[model samples]
Target: MITILNSDKNEVQKLGDLKPGDRAEIIGFEKAPVDFENFLHRLYEVGFLQGSILEVLQEAPYSRDPISIRIKEATYALRRAEANLIQVKLCE
Candidate 1:
């Protein structure tokens, strides 16, 4: 049986809402108005595009900065703006 995981409503509000210890799968990405395709391609090159698995490692206290996350075998820090483009399905 395929079971869908429940996600936090607030945390899934936007890409910037992801927090530490959250497990999620990338579902889609929001296209930026300027340089939209370029932006998407860049994210794909960095392993943040569609079908990616993400694990939040840590977030800043202010919650207005970058966040540390794990993708595949690499850990990366992304600014709030960049993260906001990546949509995800939170894993329960």
Candidate 2:
């Protein structure tokens, strides 16, 4: 699991747990699949870097598997499993 302490002692949480309208700062990544390098590369390419602020835009009402998040002026849909790999600190 990824562990990065933030100011104010807020517990770092999985990005998948964020609901619509919630904002957070990317902190780190948890252990990922075998092709972790490739996965990290893709996430970085899409702006999922440490310290980047993102806002939850939407999610599938029933399954909540695919979540839409806005980062750096762009929005992208990510699976809950994929999002679970990202650690974040909630923004007040």
Best by lDDT: 2
Error of 1 at 33 (Å): 2.6
| Top model number, TM-score | 2
Give each model's clash number.
0, 0
Once fitted onto the true fold, the runs of candidate 2 whose alpha carbons sit more than 4 angstroms away are 1-9
Q: What TM-scores do the predictions have?
A: 0.74, 0.83
For candidate 2, the per-residue lDDT at 7 reads: 67
**Which ten-residue region of model 2 has the weakest summed lDDT?**
3-12
Q: Candidate 1 — which residues are off by over 4 angstroms?
A: 1-13, 35-37, 61-64
- Please give the CA lDDT of all the candidate structures: 0.76, 0.89
